[model samples]
Target: MPNVVEPKLIAGNANQPLASAITRRMSIHRGVHIDLVDARVERFNDGEIFVEVFENVRGEDMFIIQSTSNPANDNLMELLIMADALRRSSASRVTAVIPYFGYARQDRRTKPRTPITAKLVANMLVESGISRVLTMDLHAAQIQGFFDIPVDNLYASPIFALDIREKFKDRMDEIMVVSPDVGGVARARELAKRINAPLSIVDKRREKPGEVAEMTVIGEVKDKICVMIDDMCDTAGTLCKAAELLLDYGAKEVHAYVTHGVLSGPAVERISNSVLKNLVITDTIAAPEPVKGCEQIRILPTAPLFAQAILNIWNGTSVSSLFETSTMEPIYEGVFRS
Candidate 1:
């Protein structure tokens, strides 16, 4: 934790909207005294990157806001350069604020001769002089352990859980939270416990990235409202396929609640045609225009949560209460549907 006064915020080209939202929530008037350096980035013909940060960050607490999402290599290079610049300018401390950490899904090597890119990303950050990391809803919790420096892995679940509680309160028993895969069973169970509902798991096999075949469900989802939960939604194949299977298995309705929406290539179209009633995602990573325009997709802001976390960490206060609940509360509490 450090002093809040004069905490300088820098941004790479990735997810500037999130940075701006965070700045707004902090009550810092845009562009008065504080500055957001746009690290100019360029890619060479060989696909190499070049970056330059044009601001002095000496003795200042620098928070670099960058989502290593689309064009991940370029954004990552921009962050590394900004950190290098801050360190060379003798900044007191550097905290890399990556809303959506790329390469997180590659936390483990499932096949022979594959590299663990998540650990490599951690090493790169440390080498870039990032003293600490501030990120949300990492693909794997173990990725935090990859860093020797202090890493703060924040959660968007509290925000989503609260919204779910507020939006769908009348039919608690009808709702069954589901994990799209076995890896997300823990996360889905946590949400189910919070909502005081039963949990289900979708047993699926991945033919390759973005292609999955859901075989069957492990719990009783028939005639129950199903809500699929996962850390990130990449191509949406797994989610959409799971939703289809849930429908085939007699699920009344299917909805998805995911932390990071890395909706690439065919994600939006896939979700558009799938059985999902709605897909709720957090504003950890910037949602493209297609995602925003999709009728079935919704974006929830994490600005308040991140702002509160930053304030708590700065004041040496506990953030324990934020992580306690797992259930989705009904939007209205008093009414009951018989």
Candidate 2:
């Protein structure tokens, strides 16, 4: 609110809808309508990425919103290039606002020989001259340590908890939050605590990629409405399999609330045909047309959360306050349910 350096928002082609929504929320927070920076991002005939910042960004604080989803490499390259352009143009600071950090699943090596792509990506951003990084619900929390610069890893539990409260307020007692895999129990427990529901875990085994060997319900889900929570849902195999196991265990209904819906491969089709009643996801990654067409899939906007974080960062205030579930109301209720 005080007279200070105004931050300019520049969007990459990764997720324009989310970027636009963030800017709108930023406008309301600043009490004045703010516009996105004018920029052009195109590719040459040989598939070389090109970027041009038309307006002057010298001495300005710049926030580039880009999600490394779907075409992960291209989007990542665009972000790096944009940062390079802004830094070369004399921007005071560049903050890379990434909603869905791709390659995060490979934060560590599972086998004897494998690359830590998450750290590599972090190194790339830092080398590109980015002063800070802002991301949400990283696949692995430890990935924050991969970056030497300051990194803000925003959580989606508060947002998902609000939605769960509104949708199942009357059935809170009948609801049981579930973790599709042991790795996600912590995330699921956070939402369970917020909704005041019991927690359940799906003790599952994964033999290899895109496959679920076995899933056993670890808690009492019989006849209860089960809500599965995870950081990301890719291919939907694990979620769909877990839903089936829950139903088989007598769950009245099974739903999912995931942060990043990296619904690649047969995810859309699988969710549409799975036993899960509904699959609620955040707009961290842009949903494709087929995914949008699925009746069981729903997308929630995360702009308000990101916008608030950006505002706090610019004001030199604490960002952890944004993670407090009671700090904000359910502003995006019933907006993008499909």
User: In order, what lDDT does every prediction score?
Assistant: 0.80, 0.90
Q: Could you give candidate 2's per-residue lDDT for residues 1-338 as a string of tens digits?
A: 88765789999999999999998988977888787899999999998999999999999989999999989999999999999999999999999999999999998988987899999999999999999999999998899999999999999998988888778878888999999888988898888888899999999887898777777888899989999999998889888989998999999999999999999888899999899899999999988899889999988879999998988888889888878787756444354343
Q: In model 2, state the lDDT of residue 47.
A: 89
Lowest-scoring 10 consecutive residues by lDDT in candidate 1?
Answer: 327-336
Candidate closest to the true structure, highest lDDT: 2
Using TM-score, give the best candidate's number: 2
Displacement of the residue 31 alpha carbon in candidate 2, Å = 2.0
TM-score of each: 0.88, 0.96
